[model samples]
Target: MLLKRAIGVAAGAAVVTAILVAPASGAGQADLDSAVREAMLAERGAAASADFGTPVLAEPLVEPTRSNDQGWAFGTTTIPAPDVEHAGPHTAIFVAHRQAQGWQVELDGTAEFVEAVERAPADVVSEGEKQLFARNYENSRVAVADTGLGLPWAEGVAWWMGGGPHGDSGQSRPFSSLDFNGGNGQVLSAGAGRVYKSCLRNGSGLVRVVHENGFSTTYYHMTGLTDLGDGQPVAYGDYLGRIDVGLPCGGSTTGPHVHFSLLRGDSHTKVDGQTIGGWTFREGAQAYGGYAERNGTQVGTGGRITNHGQGTSTPTGVVESGQNTSVNVRSEPRLSAPVVDELPDGSVVRIKCTARGDFVDGVWGRTDLWNQRDVGGWISDGFLYTGSDGPIAPAC
Candidate 1:
């Protein structure tokens, strides 16, 4: 099944775009991801057209979700960043299994709109391609010195499960020592990239490499090491530094382990320091190239086909849609009240309530229906098909 690939992001939105800044060292995890997402959206939007519609929430929505097996929650709505949508904000989402391809996809708001999440490249290493695989086991502990089974590089699900920590239980016995055949703190490249950042006074707290493909992989918590000039390019598996399990020099870690991460394009997707292996530990970004030509016109809390006649919403700030969709509204946007009945996607929601800002949740923009204000919550801006009627397109 091959479809025409469309351009990403809006046409010529590069004006309000922000710059990408790599953290020196000790950069906060949240800050890192935010920078990456914004840059990607800007790029994607440049090529974006009206073909794909982004789901906009009246408010933000946060819920627990499964990214790989990490079981981390995320904000469902994903808006395109100002400058790029073609590059897209680095995000992860659970694709519905109904698609038959067995490939995961970006689950934006409506399930009906998805075609495919991730399509494998022509030469992608499929299952039958490799006969037998040897797990790169340094000491039999998953996250310590583990590499892809009999492979040098890894991506997607295989990397999420293999690269991070694993045990019998969440509190299983730790590995006493991995294979003595290699260095402990010896950091290898998570992927090919240049040294965007080095061990500095205050940064991601380790050496950060920016790959050619805009991905950034970090080698965190180093104890002993020599200095390499920042921005120096290196191959995969290059020596970064050594780590002592007992030290907390750079970003504090429980034991000696290199904190690895993958930042798609924009080069600075932050890794929240809690350290959940495999899954990128960030939300999957879902952005469209342009406004989903809405014919039915999603009615806001004003009940009429208007922004209360105050002109259409002219948001000045960035609206994040991926895992940290703090800008979405979950309840109905009919009136200044909460929704009483539980409605799924595609349900005709009457604007029973409309409260400016947020009510229950802390989303920046929230709205409620008038009739059902009790169980009714924020209508989440990132839903497919605004207002009440239309040609029924897929949500991004």
Candidate 2:
């Protein structure tokens, strides 16, 4: 099954509903609800303009989760689309900030909310609070390796890999998402992390987990979500919600299955050749064309792969040159090799393969392993941040 991207439109109106969950003591639920309504109305108007056909909004399944002394509120609301016969209501995730004028609301996943926190006045938000929020935002952007993620289901359960490694934005490049079905339709967290709900209608929507190790995961078209407030912590294998044909964010699903996606920072990272749940995923020549290999067994697309549990590190790294402008990329693994280019610090790179070569004491320490870049040439793995002291990619 292919998953679609959500359309974002913003306009203005007014609608208020009762708080589905209790807010923090002293927080003004009415004011928050009113602000959210305004944002929703604007979104609906935008949707209408985009030919969504008089978009209909439902009361939030629960009160928007609040933090920083109620200075911030985030939650989901449903947009029922009667015109779309095969799809369910499209859900929207929103973030609202309390300003001197009023509550300012915007769609989540954008930088506006985070930037607002960064630019918040000291009088309105304390220094410590600002730092806390800033750290959270940074965590979402930084990429980490060896996140130790597994299948998005319970252990020992056999699930059909209906769609192999594919792009999160439909059938596109960077095959980073997988579709799975079976095991009671229950979707579980692949690892432990903070949970945030986005795109909700009635009660079904998408769930994202920002893993402690810096990687994140998103589960879309899910139903029966728990009453999880934003930023709630969840353990690995925790039941998040159920997979169904709920198109809370305007996606079409042939049947009930969770579109499990692996994310590094805000964008989806390719899962090809990455080992998860004891099976290594190999991307297909085309979208949704790949196989998961475990032991001597190779399960192709549309086949069932058992959740063997646990994950293996993938061949990826970030460039790091302490106190230097860029790290040198050579035609060969040796430092004496001709310099082909310079990789700027903090730049993420794909490790095509690796080979043992001339050792050098680099920022991460001395290593003989040299990483072959996807583009061409080689660089010291020590200078590459692969979250491992040794090599991670295949041998050259």
Best by TM-score: 2
Worst 10 residues of 1 by lDDT: 129-138
Error of 2 at 4 (Å): 26
Top candidate on lDDT is 2
TM-scores for candidates 1 onward, in order: 0.25, 0.53
**Total clashing pairs for each candidate:** 84, 4
Model 2 lDDT on a 0 to 1 scale: 0.66
lDDT of 1 by residue, 223-242 (tens): 45435554345665566665
Extract clashing residue pairs from model 2: 11-42, 12-42, 91-248, 284-289
The predictions' CA RMSDs to the true structure, in order, are 24.6, 14.8
Alpha carbon deviation, residue 306, candidate 1 (Å): 58
Name the lDDT of candidate 1. Answer: 0.28
Q: Which stretches of candidate 1 lie over 4 Å from their true place?
A: 1-183, 202-204, 245-251, 267-396
lDDT of 2 at 68: 54
Candidate 1 colliding pairs, count = 84
